[model samples]
Target: MSRLSDMLRTQRFDDYRFYHQSTINQTLHLISAIIFLGCYALLFTDAAIAGIVGWLAMLTRQTGHFFFEPNGYDAVNDVSNDYKEAVKVGYNQTRKIILLLVWGSAPVALYVYPTLFGLFDPPTDRFDFVRHVGTLWLAIGIGGGLARMLQLFATRDLTTGLVWAFKVLTDPFHNIALYWKSPLKLLRGELIDSSIADADWGADEVEEAPHLT
Candidate 1:
Protein backbone atom coordinates (compact mmCIF):
# COMPACT_ATOMS: atom_id res chain seq x y z
CA MET A 1 0.00 0.00 0.00
CA SER A 2 2.77 2.39 0.84
CA ARG A 3 4.57 1.55 -2.38
CA LEU A 4 1.42 2.12 -4.40
CA SER A 5 0.97 5.50 -2.79
CA ASP A 6 4.53 6.44 -3.60
CA MET A 7 4.22 5.27 -7.18
CA LEU A 8 1.04 7.30 -7.57
CA ARG A 9 2.82 10.43 -6.37
CA THR A 10 5.72 9.86 -8.73
CA GLN A 11 3.38 9.39 -11.66
CA ARG A 12 1.40 12.48 -10.77
CA PHE A 13 4.51 14.58 -10.29
CA ASP A 14 6.01 13.42 -13.54
CA ASP A 15 2.74 14.14 -15.33
CA TYR A 16 2.59 17.61 -13.87
CA ARG A 17 6.15 18.70 -14.65
CA PHE A 18 6.21 17.15 -18.10
CA TYR A 19 2.82 17.66 -19.75
CA HIS A 20 1.64 20.84 -18.07
CA GLN A 21 4.11 23.45 -19.29
CA SER A 22 1.58 25.67 -20.98
CA THR A 23 -0.53 27.72 -18.65
CA ILE A 24 -3.29 27.45 -21.23
CA ASN A 25 -3.15 23.67 -21.18
CA GLN A 26 -3.07 23.65 -17.40
CA THR A 27 -6.02 26.01 -17.34
CA LEU A 28 -8.00 23.83 -19.68
CA HIS A 29 -7.18 20.81 -17.51
CA LEU A 30 -8.44 22.79 -14.54
CA ILE A 31 -11.76 23.35 -16.27
CA SER A 32 -11.99 19.68 -17.25
CA ALA A 33 -11.20 18.65 -13.71
CA ILE A 34 -14.03 20.76 -12.33
CA ILE A 35 -16.48 19.25 -14.80
CA PHE A 36 -15.26 15.76 -14.00
CA LEU A 37 -15.83 16.38 -10.29
CA GLY A 38 -19.40 17.35 -11.06
CA CYS A 39 -19.73 14.33 -13.30
CA TYR A 40 -18.59 12.10 -10.47
CA ALA A 41 -21.22 13.57 -8.22
CA LEU A 42 -23.95 12.92 -10.77
CA LEU A 43 -22.87 9.30 -11.33
CA PHE A 44 -24.92 8.00 -8.39
CA THR A 45 -28.10 9.81 -9.35
CA ASP A 46 -27.87 9.40 -13.15
CA ALA A 47 -25.25 7.33 -14.96
CA ALA A 48 -26.14 8.58 -18.46
CA ILE A 49 -25.74 12.15 -17.37
CA ALA A 50 -22.45 11.25 -15.68
CA GLY A 51 -21.20 9.55 -18.80
CA ILE A 52 -21.99 12.47 -21.07
CA VAL A 53 -20.47 15.02 -18.74
CA GLY A 54 -17.44 12.78 -18.16
CA TRP A 55 -16.84 12.53 -21.90
CA LEU A 56 -17.01 16.29 -22.21
CA ALA A 57 -14.38 16.58 -19.50
CA MET A 58 -12.30 13.93 -21.23
CA LEU A 59 -12.51 15.82 -24.52
CA THR A 60 -11.41 19.07 -22.90
CA ARG A 61 -8.45 17.37 -21.22
CA GLN A 62 -7.32 15.59 -24.37
CA THR A 63 -7.68 18.78 -26.41
CA GLY A 64 -5.02 20.33 -24.26
CA HIS A 65 -2.69 17.39 -24.85
CA PHE A 66 -3.41 17.24 -28.58
CA PHE A 67 -3.34 20.96 -29.35
CA PHE A 68 -2.04 23.26 -26.68
CA GLU A 69 0.88 21.19 -25.36
CA PRO A 70 4.18 21.53 -27.18
CA ASN A 71 5.77 18.82 -29.30
CA GLY A 72 9.46 19.48 -29.61
CA TYR A 73 12.76 18.82 -27.91
CA ASP A 74 12.02 19.14 -24.23
CA ALA A 75 14.89 21.10 -22.70
CA VAL A 76 13.07 21.23 -19.39
CA ASN A 77 13.25 17.47 -18.89
CA ASP A 78 16.22 16.86 -21.20
CA VAL A 79 14.57 13.87 -22.85
CA SER A 80 13.51 13.12 -26.41
CA ASN A 81 9.81 12.71 -27.23
CA ASP A 82 10.46 9.15 -28.37
CA TYR A 83 12.14 8.23 -25.13
CA LYS A 84 9.29 9.50 -23.01
CA GLU A 85 6.66 7.78 -25.10
CA ALA A 86 8.53 4.53 -24.88
CA VAL A 87 8.62 4.43 -21.09
CA LYS A 88 5.20 5.85 -20.36
CA VAL A 89 3.32 3.45 -18.09
CA GLY A 90 -0.03 4.79 -19.18
CA TYR A 91 -1.29 5.68 -22.67
CA ASN A 92 1.49 7.25 -24.67
CA GLN A 93 1.09 9.21 -27.88
CA THR A 94 0.75 6.07 -30.00
CA ARG A 95 -1.93 4.58 -27.77
CA LYS A 96 -3.64 7.94 -27.49
CA ILE A 97 -3.81 8.26 -31.28
CA ILE A 98 -5.46 4.86 -31.58
CA LEU A 99 -7.91 5.71 -28.82
CA LEU A 100 -8.74 9.05 -30.40
CA LEU A 101 -9.24 7.41 -33.78
CA VAL A 102 -11.75 5.00 -32.33
CA TRP A 103 -13.48 7.80 -30.47
CA GLY A 104 -13.72 9.84 -33.68
CA SER A 105 -15.12 6.91 -35.67
CA ALA A 106 -17.74 5.99 -33.07
CA PRO A 107 -20.33 8.41 -34.39
CA VAL A 108 -19.93 7.13 -37.92
CA ALA A 109 -20.29 3.57 -36.72
CA LEU A 110 -23.47 4.48 -34.86
CA TYR A 111 -24.80 6.27 -37.92
CA VAL A 112 -24.27 3.27 -40.15
CA TYR A 113 -25.44 0.71 -37.64
CA PRO A 114 -28.04 2.37 -35.49
CA THR A 115 -28.19 -0.67 -33.24
CA LEU A 116 -24.44 -0.29 -32.67
CA PHE A 117 -23.52 -3.96 -33.03
CA GLY A 118 -26.50 -4.89 -30.84
CA LEU A 119 -25.26 -2.87 -27.87
CA PHE A 120 -27.91 -0.18 -28.28
CA ASP A 121 -31.34 0.11 -29.82
CA PRO A 122 -31.86 1.84 -33.15
CA PRO A 123 -32.28 5.56 -32.67
CA THR A 124 -35.75 6.96 -33.33
CA ASP A 125 -34.47 10.50 -34.08
CA ARG A 126 -31.38 12.70 -34.15
CA PHE A 127 -31.54 13.23 -30.40
CA ASP A 128 -31.72 9.53 -29.90
CA PHE A 129 -28.85 9.07 -32.28
CA VAL A 130 -26.77 11.47 -30.24
CA ARG A 131 -27.81 9.70 -27.06
CA HIS A 132 -26.72 6.42 -28.57
CA VAL A 133 -23.37 7.93 -29.43
CA GLY A 134 -23.02 9.14 -25.89
CA THR A 135 -23.89 5.72 -24.57
CA LEU A 136 -21.30 4.08 -26.79
CA TRP A 137 -18.70 6.67 -25.90
CA LEU A 138 -19.36 5.95 -22.25
CA ALA A 139 -18.66 2.30 -22.82
CA ILE A 140 -15.56 3.12 -24.79
CA GLY A 141 -14.31 5.37 -22.03
CA ILE A 142 -14.74 2.66 -19.42
CA GLY A 143 -13.33 -0.04 -21.63
CA GLY A 144 -10.30 2.00 -22.56
CA GLY A 145 -9.49 2.53 -18.91
CA LEU A 146 -9.86 -1.13 -17.99
CA ALA A 147 -7.90 -2.23 -21.03
CA ARG A 148 -4.98 -0.02 -20.07
CA MET A 149 -5.08 -1.21 -16.51
CA LEU A 150 -4.91 -4.82 -17.62
CA GLN A 151 -2.18 -4.00 -20.10
CA LEU A 152 -0.13 -2.50 -17.33
CA PHE A 153 -0.61 -5.58 -15.21
CA ALA A 154 0.80 -7.61 -18.08
CA THR A 155 3.77 -5.37 -18.92
CA ARG A 156 4.48 -3.86 -15.56
CA ASP A 157 3.63 -5.10 -12.05
CA LEU A 158 0.20 -5.57 -10.55
CA THR A 159 0.79 -2.74 -8.10
CA THR A 160 1.82 -0.33 -10.85
CA GLY A 161 -1.25 -1.19 -12.86
CA LEU A 162 -3.60 -0.71 -9.97
CA VAL A 163 -1.92 2.53 -8.95
CA TRP A 164 -2.12 3.92 -12.44
CA ALA A 165 -5.82 3.07 -12.53
CA PHE A 166 -6.30 4.81 -9.22
CA LYS A 167 -4.44 7.84 -10.50
CA VAL A 168 -6.62 8.13 -13.59
CA LEU A 169 -9.86 7.73 -11.65
CA THR A 170 -8.87 10.38 -9.12
CA ASP A 171 -7.23 12.65 -11.68
CA PRO A 172 -10.06 15.17 -11.66
CA PHE A 173 -9.82 15.95 -7.99
CA HIS A 174 -6.04 15.89 -8.12
CA ASN A 175 -5.79 18.10 -11.19
CA ILE A 176 -8.14 20.65 -9.73
CA ALA A 177 -6.05 20.83 -6.59
CA LEU A 178 -2.81 21.02 -8.56
CA TYR A 179 -3.80 23.45 -11.32
CA TRP A 180 -6.40 25.76 -9.82
CA LYS A 181 -3.96 28.67 -10.06
CA SER A 182 -3.05 28.13 -13.71
CA PRO A 183 -5.54 30.65 -15.02
CA LEU A 184 -4.26 33.29 -12.68
CA LYS A 185 -0.73 32.56 -13.81
CA LEU A 186 -1.80 32.95 -17.43
CA LEU A 187 -3.51 36.22 -16.67
CA ARG A 188 -0.23 37.37 -15.19
CA GLY A 189 1.28 36.86 -18.66
CA GLU A 190 3.05 33.62 -17.89
CA LEU A 191 2.71 31.57 -21.01
CA ILE A 192 5.07 28.68 -20.27
CA ASP A 193 5.99 27.15 -16.97
CA SER A 194 9.40 27.64 -15.51
CA SER A 195 11.99 24.94 -15.96
CA ILE A 196 12.62 22.44 -13.24
CA ALA A 197 16.21 22.51 -12.05
CA ASP A 198 17.92 19.13 -12.05
CA ALA A 199 14.84 17.27 -10.95
CA ASP A 200 15.62 13.57 -10.96
CA TRP A 201 12.68 11.60 -12.43
CA GLY A 202 13.82 8.34 -10.77
CA ALA A 203 14.86 6.91 -14.08
CA ASP A 204 16.14 3.84 -12.25
CA GLU A 205 12.57 2.95 -11.22
CA VAL A 206 10.65 4.67 -14.03
CA GLU A 207 12.45 4.41 -17.32
CA GLU A 208 11.82 7.92 -18.67
CA ALA A 209 9.99 11.14 -18.05
CA PRO A 210 8.98 13.33 -20.98
CA HIS A 211 8.39 17.03 -20.79
CA LEU A 212 5.99 19.15 -22.82
CA THR A 213 7.04 18.20 -26.29
Candidate 2:
Protein backbone atom coordinates (compact mmCIF):
# COMPACT_ATOMS: atom_id res chain seq x y z
CA MET A 1 0.00 0.00 0.00
CA SER A 2 2.80 2.40 0.81
CA ARG A 3 4.59 1.67 -2.44
CA LEU A 4 1.40 2.15 -4.42
CA SER A 5 0.71 5.46 -2.71
CA ASP A 6 4.25 6.64 -3.32
CA MET A 7 4.16 5.77 -6.99
CA LEU A 8 0.80 7.43 -7.40
CA ARG A 9 2.13 10.58 -5.78
CA THR A 10 5.23 10.54 -7.93
CA GLN A 11 3.17 10.11 -11.12
CA ARG A 12 0.83 12.93 -10.14
CA PHE A 13 3.67 15.24 -9.23
CA ASP A 14 5.57 14.46 -12.39
CA ASP A 15 2.41 14.94 -14.44
CA TYR A 16 1.79 18.37 -12.95
CA ARG A 17 5.35 19.60 -13.28
CA PHE A 18 5.95 18.17 -16.74
CA TYR A 19 2.64 18.80 -18.49
CA HIS A 20 0.48 21.33 -16.64
CA GLN A 21 2.56 24.48 -16.65
CA SER A 22 -0.04 26.78 -18.15
CA THR A 23 -2.50 28.43 -15.81
CA ILE A 24 -4.99 28.38 -18.64
CA ASN A 25 -4.44 24.66 -19.01
CA GLN A 26 -4.86 24.11 -15.29
CA THR A 27 -8.07 26.13 -15.29
CA LEU A 28 -9.38 24.15 -18.23
CA HIS A 29 -8.49 20.96 -16.42
CA LEU A 30 -10.50 22.18 -13.46
CA ILE A 31 -13.50 22.67 -15.71
CA SER A 32 -12.90 19.34 -17.38
CA ALA A 33 -12.66 17.67 -14.01
CA ILE A 34 -16.04 19.04 -13.03
CA ILE A 35 -17.57 17.83 -16.26
CA PHE A 36 -16.00 14.42 -15.71
CA LEU A 37 -17.66 14.23 -12.31
CA GLY A 38 -20.96 14.84 -14.05
CA CYS A 39 -20.15 12.05 -16.45
CA TYR A 40 -19.35 9.75 -13.55
CA ALA A 41 -22.69 10.48 -11.95
CA LEU A 42 -24.53 9.73 -15.16
CA LEU A 43 -22.58 6.54 -15.80
CA PHE A 44 -24.88 4.35 -13.73
CA THR A 45 -28.20 5.69 -14.97
CA ASP A 46 -27.36 6.71 -18.54
CA ALA A 47 -24.11 5.38 -19.97
CA ALA A 48 -24.67 6.97 -23.38
CA ILE A 49 -25.12 10.37 -21.80
CA ALA A 50 -22.09 9.71 -19.63
CA GLY A 51 -20.07 8.92 -22.73
CA ILE A 52 -21.11 12.16 -24.40
CA VAL A 53 -20.23 14.10 -21.26
CA GLY A 54 -16.93 12.24 -20.88
CA TRP A 55 -15.83 13.07 -24.41
CA LEU A 56 -16.81 16.68 -23.92
CA ALA A 57 -14.61 16.81 -20.84
CA MET A 58 -11.79 15.05 -22.68
CA LEU A 59 -11.91 17.58 -25.51
CA THR A 60 -11.86 20.43 -23.04
CA ARG A 61 -8.86 18.92 -21.26
CA GLN A 62 -6.97 18.10 -24.44
CA THR A 63 -7.53 21.55 -25.89
CA GLY A 64 -5.54 22.97 -23.02
CA HIS A 65 -2.67 20.53 -23.52
CA PHE A 66 -2.62 20.94 -27.29
CA PHE A 67 -3.06 24.69 -27.54
CA PHE A 68 -1.95 26.26 -24.28
CA GLU A 69 0.77 24.14 -22.67
CA PRO A 70 4.31 24.74 -23.73
CA ASN A 71 5.92 22.04 -25.84
CA GLY A 72 9.48 23.30 -25.87
CA TYR A 73 12.52 22.36 -23.86
CA ASP A 74 11.66 22.35 -20.18
CA ALA A 75 13.93 24.84 -18.51
CA VAL A 76 12.53 23.89 -15.12
CA ASN A 77 12.69 20.13 -15.52
CA ASP A 78 15.93 20.28 -17.53
CA VAL A 79 14.61 17.83 -20.11
CA SER A 80 13.91 18.05 -23.79
CA ASN A 81 10.40 17.66 -25.22
CA ASP A 82 11.37 14.37 -26.79
CA TYR A 83 12.66 13.05 -23.48
CA LYS A 84 9.41 13.87 -21.77
CA GLU A 85 7.35 12.29 -24.51
CA ALA A 86 9.45 9.18 -24.43
CA VAL A 87 9.07 8.70 -20.68
CA LYS A 88 5.46 9.80 -20.37
CA VAL A 89 3.40 7.24 -18.45
CA GLY A 90 0.18 7.78 -20.33
CA TYR A 91 -0.56 8.79 -23.94
CA ASN A 92 2.17 10.95 -25.38
CA GLN A 93 1.30 13.45 -28.09
CA THR A 94 1.73 10.89 -30.88
CA ARG A 95 -0.37 8.28 -29.16
CA LYS A 96 -2.93 10.90 -28.23
CA ILE A 97 -3.22 11.91 -31.87
CA ILE A 98 -3.87 8.34 -32.89
CA LEU A 99 -6.45 7.90 -30.14
CA LEU A 100 -8.16 11.13 -31.09
CA LEU A 101 -8.27 10.11 -34.73
CA VAL A 102 -9.92 6.84 -33.81
CA TRP A 103 -12.34 8.70 -31.56
CA GLY A 104 -13.15 11.21 -34.28
CA SER A 105 -13.69 8.52 -36.90
CA ALA A 106 -16.09 6.42 -34.84
CA PRO A 107 -19.10 8.62 -35.41
CA VAL A 108 -18.37 9.00 -39.08
CA ALA A 109 -18.03 5.26 -39.48
CA LEU A 110 -21.26 4.72 -37.60
CA TYR A 111 -22.97 7.35 -39.71
CA VAL A 112 -21.95 5.68 -42.95
CA TYR A 113 -22.57 2.11 -41.91
CA PRO A 114 -25.53 2.81 -39.57
CA THR A 115 -25.22 -0.62 -38.04
CA LEU A 116 -21.40 -0.53 -38.16
CA PHE A 117 -21.26 -3.83 -40.10
CA GLY A 118 -23.80 -5.42 -37.78
CA LEU A 119 -22.04 -4.46 -34.54
CA PHE A 120 -24.91 -2.20 -33.56
CA ASP A 121 -28.65 -2.26 -34.21
CA PRO A 122 -29.91 0.27 -36.72
CA PRO A 123 -31.04 3.43 -34.99
CA THR A 124 -34.69 4.38 -35.24
CA ASP A 125 -34.01 8.13 -35.12
CA ARG A 126 -31.32 10.80 -34.81
CA PHE A 127 -31.34 10.64 -31.02
CA ASP A 128 -30.91 6.89 -31.14
CA PHE A 129 -28.02 7.28 -33.53
CA VAL A 130 -26.35 9.73 -31.18
CA ARG A 131 -26.91 7.37 -28.27
CA HIS A 132 -25.35 4.55 -30.22
CA VAL A 133 -22.36 6.71 -31.02
CA GLY A 134 -22.07 7.67 -27.39
CA THR A 135 -22.16 4.04 -26.36
CA LEU A 136 -19.41 3.25 -28.82
CA TRP A 137 -17.40 6.22 -27.62
CA LEU A 138 -17.76 4.99 -24.07
CA ALA A 139 -16.40 1.63 -25.11
CA ILE A 140 -13.52 3.22 -26.95
CA GLY A 141 -12.63 5.30 -23.92
CA ILE A 142 -12.58 2.23 -21.68
CA GLY A 143 -10.74 0.17 -24.23
CA GLY A 144 -8.11 2.83 -24.73
CA GLY A 145 -7.39 3.05 -21.02
CA LEU A 146 -7.41 -0.69 -20.53
CA ALA A 147 -5.16 -1.27 -23.51
CA ARG A 148 -2.57 1.07 -22.06
CA MET A 149 -2.89 -0.53 -18.67
CA LEU A 150 -2.26 -3.94 -20.14
CA GLN A 151 0.71 -2.61 -22.07
CA LEU A 152 2.17 -1.29 -18.85
CA PHE A 153 1.66 -4.67 -17.22
CA ALA A 154 3.70 -6.27 -19.99
CA THR A 155 6.42 -3.63 -20.23
CA ARG A 156 6.69 -2.42 -16.65
CA ASP A 157 5.21 -4.28 -13.69
CA LEU A 158 1.85 -5.20 -12.25
CA THR A 159 2.10 -2.49 -9.61
CA THR A 160 2.94 0.20 -12.14
CA GLY A 161 0.04 -0.76 -14.36
CA LEU A 162 -2.41 -0.85 -11.45
CA VAL A 163 -1.17 2.47 -10.10
CA TRP A 164 -1.53 4.20 -13.44
CA ALA A 165 -5.02 2.83 -13.87
CA PHE A 166 -5.96 4.06 -10.43
CA LYS A 167 -4.51 7.47 -11.15
CA VAL A 168 -6.50 7.81 -14.37
CA LEU A 169 -9.73 6.71 -12.73
CA THR A 170 -9.38 9.16 -9.84
CA ASP A 171 -7.93 12.07 -11.80
CA PRO A 172 -11.13 14.09 -11.89
CA PHE A 173 -11.37 14.42 -8.16
CA HIS A 174 -7.64 14.95 -7.90
CA ASN A 175 -7.63 17.66 -10.57
CA ILE A 176 -10.35 19.56 -8.81
CA ALA A 177 -8.37 19.40 -5.61
CA LEU A 178 -5.09 20.38 -7.22
CA TYR A 179 -6.27 23.09 -9.57
CA TRP A 180 -9.11 24.80 -7.79
CA LYS A 181 -7.01 27.93 -7.44
CA SER A 182 -5.76 27.90 -11.02
CA PRO A 183 -8.52 30.20 -12.23
CA LEU A 184 -7.57 32.84 -9.72
CA LYS A 185 -3.96 32.54 -10.81
CA LEU A 186 -5.00 32.96 -14.43
CA LEU A 187 -7.07 35.99 -13.48
CA ARG A 188 -3.92 37.48 -11.99
CA GLY A 189 -2.31 37.34 -15.43
CA GLU A 190 -0.10 34.43 -14.61
CA LEU A 191 0.15 32.59 -17.88
CA ILE A 192 2.61 30.04 -16.58
CA ASP A 193 2.75 28.20 -13.29
CA SER A 194 5.84 29.77 -11.85
CA SER A 195 5.67 27.61 -8.77
CA ILE A 196 6.40 24.51 -10.77
CA ALA A 197 10.06 25.41 -10.59
CA ASP A 198 9.85 25.02 -6.84
CA ALA A 199 8.67 21.41 -7.07
CA ASP A 200 11.15 19.32 -5.12
CA TRP A 201 10.32 15.63 -4.99
CA GLY A 202 13.97 14.70 -4.45
CA ALA A 203 16.10 13.32 -7.24
CA ASP A 204 16.36 9.92 -5.62
CA GLU A 205 12.60 9.48 -5.79
CA VAL A 206 12.33 9.97 -9.54
CA GLU A 207 11.27 6.84 -11.40
CA GLU A 208 13.91 5.51 -13.78
CA ALA A 209 11.39 3.45 -15.71
CA PRO A 210 9.04 4.71 -18.41
CA HIS A 211 5.67 5.93 -17.17
CA LEU A 212 2.17 5.11 -18.39
CA THR A 213 0.32 6.35 -21.52
Candidate 3:
Protein backbone atom coordinates (compact mmCIF):
# COMPACT_ATOMS: atom_id res chain seq x y z
CA MET A 1 0.00 0.00 0.00
CA SER A 2 2.72 2.44 0.91
CA ARG A 3 4.62 1.74 -2.31
CA LEU A 4 1.49 2.15 -4.40
CA SER A 5 0.67 5.41 -2.66
CA ASP A 6 4.21 6.73 -3.18
CA MET A 7 4.24 5.86 -6.88
CA LEU A 8 0.83 7.50 -7.36
CA ARG A 9 2.09 10.70 -5.72
CA THR A 10 5.23 10.68 -7.83
CA GLN A 11 3.28 10.21 -11.07
CA ARG A 12 0.88 13.02 -10.18
CA PHE A 13 3.71 15.36 -9.19
CA ASP A 14 5.62 14.60 -12.37
CA ASP A 15 2.46 15.16 -14.46
CA TYR A 16 1.91 18.59 -12.94
CA ARG A 17 5.54 19.69 -13.07
CA PHE A 18 6.25 18.39 -16.55
CA TYR A 19 2.96 18.85 -18.40
CA HIS A 20 0.67 21.31 -16.64
CA GLN A 21 2.85 24.38 -16.21
CA SER A 22 0.48 26.82 -17.83
CA THR A 23 -2.25 28.58 -15.89
CA ILE A 24 -4.53 28.49 -18.89
CA ASN A 25 -4.01 24.78 -19.23
CA GLN A 26 -4.66 24.30 -15.57
CA THR A 27 -7.85 26.32 -15.75
CA LEU A 28 -9.04 24.33 -18.72
CA HIS A 29 -8.29 21.12 -16.84
CA LEU A 30 -10.44 22.40 -14.00
CA ILE A 31 -13.34 22.91 -16.37
CA SER A 32 -12.68 19.56 -17.99
CA ALA A 33 -12.65 17.90 -14.61
CA ILE A 34 -16.07 19.31 -13.79
CA ILE A 35 -17.48 18.13 -17.08
CA PHE A 36 -15.96 14.70 -16.49
CA LEU A 37 -17.82 14.50 -13.20
CA GLY A 38 -21.06 15.15 -15.04
CA CYS A 39 -20.15 12.43 -17.50
CA TYR A 40 -19.48 10.06 -14.65
CA ALA A 41 -22.89 10.72 -13.15
CA LEU A 42 -24.56 9.95 -16.44
CA LEU A 43 -22.55 6.82 -17.08
CA PHE A 44 -24.93 4.38 -15.38
CA THR A 45 -28.16 6.05 -16.44
CA ASP A 46 -27.36 6.96 -20.04
CA ALA A 47 -24.23 5.62 -21.70
CA ALA A 48 -24.83 7.69 -24.83
CA ILE A 49 -25.01 11.00 -22.99
CA ALA A 50 -22.09 9.92 -20.83
CA GLY A 51 -19.95 9.23 -23.90
CA ILE A 52 -20.76 12.61 -25.48
CA VAL A 53 -20.08 14.47 -22.25
CA GLY A 54 -16.90 12.50 -21.66
CA TRP A 55 -15.53 13.38 -25.10
CA LEU A 56 -16.42 17.05 -24.58
CA ALA A 57 -14.33 17.07 -21.39
CA MET A 58 -11.51 15.31 -23.21
CA LEU A 59 -11.53 17.99 -25.92
CA THR A 60 -11.08 20.76 -23.38
CA ARG A 61 -8.29 18.86 -21.64
CA GLN A 62 -6.43 18.06 -24.84
CA THR A 63 -6.89 21.58 -26.21
CA GLY A 64 -4.91 22.86 -23.26
CA HIS A 65 -2.11 20.40 -23.89
CA PHE A 66 -2.05 20.86 -27.65
CA PHE A 67 -2.45 24.62 -27.82
CA PHE A 68 -1.67 26.31 -24.50
CA GLU A 69 1.01 24.23 -22.77
CA PRO A 70 4.60 24.97 -23.66
CA ASN A 71 6.29 22.24 -25.66
CA GLY A 72 9.87 23.32 -25.50
CA TYR A 73 12.94 22.67 -23.39
CA ASP A 74 11.55 22.63 -19.85
CA ALA A 75 14.05 24.75 -17.95
CA VAL A 76 12.24 24.28 -14.65
CA ASN A 77 12.51 20.50 -14.95
CA ASP A 78 15.85 20.68 -16.77
CA VAL A 79 14.61 18.31 -19.48
CA SER A 80 13.83 18.60 -23.16
CA ASN A 81 10.27 18.14 -24.43
CA ASP A 82 11.39 15.03 -26.27
CA TYR A 83 12.77 13.58 -23.07
CA LYS A 84 9.49 14.17 -21.27
CA GLU A 85 7.47 12.54 -24.02
CA ALA A 86 9.75 9.54 -24.08
CA VAL A 87 9.38 8.91 -20.37
CA LYS A 88 5.67 9.65 -20.07
CA VAL A 89 4.01 6.64 -18.38
CA GLY A 90 0.72 7.04 -20.18
CA TYR A 91 -0.09 8.24 -23.72
CA ASN A 92 2.60 10.48 -25.12
CA GLN A 93 1.83 12.99 -27.86
CA THR A 94 2.41 10.44 -30.61
CA ARG A 95 0.22 7.83 -28.99
CA LYS A 96 -2.41 10.46 -28.21
CA ILE A 97 -2.52 11.45 -31.86
CA ILE A 98 -3.12 7.87 -32.92
CA LEU A 99 -5.83 7.41 -30.30
CA LEU A 100 -7.51 10.64 -31.34
CA LEU A 101 -7.44 9.62 -34.99
CA VAL A 102 -9.20 6.40 -34.13
CA TRP A 103 -11.71 8.34 -32.03
CA GLY A 104 -12.35 10.82 -34.84
CA SER A 105 -12.81 8.05 -37.40
CA ALA A 106 -15.51 6.26 -35.43
CA PRO A 107 -18.20 8.82 -36.21
CA VAL A 108 -17.34 9.00 -39.89
CA ALA A 109 -17.28 5.22 -40.14
CA LEU A 110 -20.67 5.06 -38.47
CA TYR A 111 -22.05 7.68 -40.82
CA VAL A 112 -20.99 5.70 -43.85
CA TYR A 113 -21.96 2.31 -42.54
CA PRO A 114 -25.04 2.85 -40.45
CA THR A 115 -24.92 -0.65 -39.04
CA LEU A 116 -21.12 -0.50 -38.64
CA PHE A 117 -20.69 -3.66 -40.73
CA GLY A 118 -23.32 -5.43 -38.64
CA LEU A 119 -21.79 -4.51 -35.29
CA PHE A 120 -24.78 -2.33 -34.39
CA ASP A 121 -28.41 -2.36 -35.46
CA PRO A 122 -29.37 0.07 -38.22
CA PRO A 123 -30.47 3.42 -36.79
CA THR A 124 -34.13 4.34 -37.12
CA ASP A 125 -33.46 8.11 -37.15
CA ARG A 126 -30.79 10.76 -36.65
CA PHE A 127 -31.07 10.60 -32.87
CA ASP A 128 -30.59 6.86 -32.99
CA PHE A 129 -27.53 7.28 -35.18
CA VAL A 130 -26.05 9.71 -32.68
CA ARG A 131 -26.87 7.32 -29.85
CA HIS A 132 -25.13 4.51 -31.70
CA VAL A 133 -22.10 6.71 -32.22
CA GLY A 134 -22.03 7.58 -28.54
CA THR A 135 -22.27 3.92 -27.56
CA LEU A 136 -19.40 3.01 -29.89
CA TRP A 137 -17.41 5.96 -28.51
CA LEU A 138 -17.99 4.75 -24.98
CA ALA A 139 -16.64 1.36 -25.97
CA ILE A 140 -13.64 2.89 -27.66
CA GLY A 141 -12.84 4.96 -24.60
CA ILE A 142 -12.88 1.91 -22.33
CA GLY A 143 -11.02 -0.26 -24.80
CA GLY A 144 -8.33 2.39 -25.28
CA GLY A 145 -7.66 2.63 -21.57
CA LEU A 146 -7.62 -1.11 -21.09
CA ALA A 147 -5.37 -1.66 -24.08
CA ARG A 148 -2.82 0.79 -22.69
CA MET A 149 -3.06 -0.73 -19.27
CA LEU A 150 -2.32 -4.16 -20.68
CA GLN A 151 0.56 -2.77 -22.67
CA LEU A 152 2.05 -1.30 -19.54
CA PHE A 153 1.69 -4.62 -17.77
CA ALA A 154 3.86 -6.19 -20.47
CA THR A 155 6.34 -3.31 -20.70
CA ARG A 156 6.69 -2.17 -17.12
CA ASP A 157 5.27 -4.17 -14.19
CA LEU A 158 1.90 -5.07 -12.73
CA THR A 159 2.05 -2.41 -10.06
CA THR A 160 2.98 0.34 -12.50
CA GLY A 161 0.20 -0.63 -14.87
CA LEU A 162 -2.40 -0.73 -12.10
CA VAL A 163 -1.23 2.54 -10.62
CA TRP A 164 -1.43 4.35 -13.95
CA ALA A 165 -4.90 2.96 -14.53
CA PHE A 166 -5.99 4.14 -11.08
CA LYS A 167 -4.55 7.58 -11.70
CA VAL A 168 -6.39 7.93 -14.99
CA LEU A 169 -9.67 6.83 -13.44
CA THR A 170 -9.46 9.26 -10.49
CA ASP A 171 -7.93 12.21 -12.38
CA PRO A 172 -11.12 14.23 -12.55
CA PHE A 173 -11.45 14.55 -8.77
CA HIS A 174 -7.73 15.05 -8.43
CA ASN A 175 -7.60 17.76 -11.09
CA ILE A 176 -10.28 19.75 -9.32
CA ALA A 177 -8.36 19.54 -6.06
CA LEU A 178 -5.04 20.49 -7.66
CA TYR A 179 -6.10 23.17 -10.14
CA TRP A 180 -8.98 24.95 -8.41
CA LYS A 181 -6.82 28.04 -7.93
CA SER A 182 -5.77 28.20 -11.55
CA PRO A 183 -8.56 30.48 -12.73
CA LEU A 184 -7.69 33.08 -10.14
CA LYS A 185 -4.04 32.86 -11.11
CA LEU A 186 -4.97 33.30 -14.76
CA LEU A 187 -7.10 36.29 -13.85
CA ARG A 188 -4.07 37.79 -12.15
CA GLY A 189 -2.19 37.56 -15.45
CA GLU A 190 0.06 34.79 -14.31
CA LEU A 191 0.27 32.75 -17.46
CA ILE A 192 2.79 30.24 -16.17
CA ASP A 193 2.83 28.29 -12.95
CA SER A 194 5.88 29.81 -11.35
CA SER A 195 5.62 27.62 -8.27
CA ILE A 196 6.47 24.58 -10.38
CA ALA A 197 10.11 25.58 -10.28
CA ASP A 198 10.16 25.21 -6.53
CA ALA A 199 8.25 21.94 -6.43
CA ASP A 200 11.27 19.81 -5.76
CA TRP A 201 10.50 16.08 -5.64
CA GLY A 202 13.71 14.87 -3.95
CA ALA A 203 15.57 14.21 -7.16
CA ASP A 204 17.98 11.78 -5.51
CA GLU A 205 15.22 9.74 -3.88
CA VAL A 206 12.63 9.48 -6.65
CA GLU A 207 13.35 7.91 -9.99
CA GLU A 208 14.28 10.61 -12.52
CA ALA A 209 11.35 9.53 -14.68
CA PRO A 210 9.51 6.46 -15.86
CA HIS A 211 11.37 4.25 -18.29
CA LEU A 212 10.06 4.18 -21.83
CA THR A 213 9.35 0.80 -23.33
Candidate 3 whole-model C-alpha lDDT, 0 to 1? 0.91
lDDT of 2 at 31: 100
Instruction: Please write out the lDDT profile of model 1 over residues 104-165, one tens digit for every residue.
Output: 89999988888977888777888888777777777888899999998888877788789989
Sort all candidates by TM-score, best to worst: 3, 2, 1
* Candidate 2 vs. true structure, TM-score: 0.95
- lDDT of candidate 3 over 1-213, digit per residue (tens): 978988888888889898999999999999999999999999989999799889989889999999999999999888999999998988889988988999999999999999998998989999999898889888888899999999989999998889999999999999999999999999999999999887775553245785667
Global lDDT of each model? 0.80, 0.91, 0.91
- The 10-residue segment of model 3 with minimum total lDDT is 201-210
What's the CA error at residue 194 for candidate 3, in Å?
A: 0.6
- RMSD of each predicted structure: 3.4, 1.8, 1.4
Could you give candidate 2's per-residue lDDT for residues 171-209 as a string of tens digits?
Answer: 999999999999999999999999888877666345453
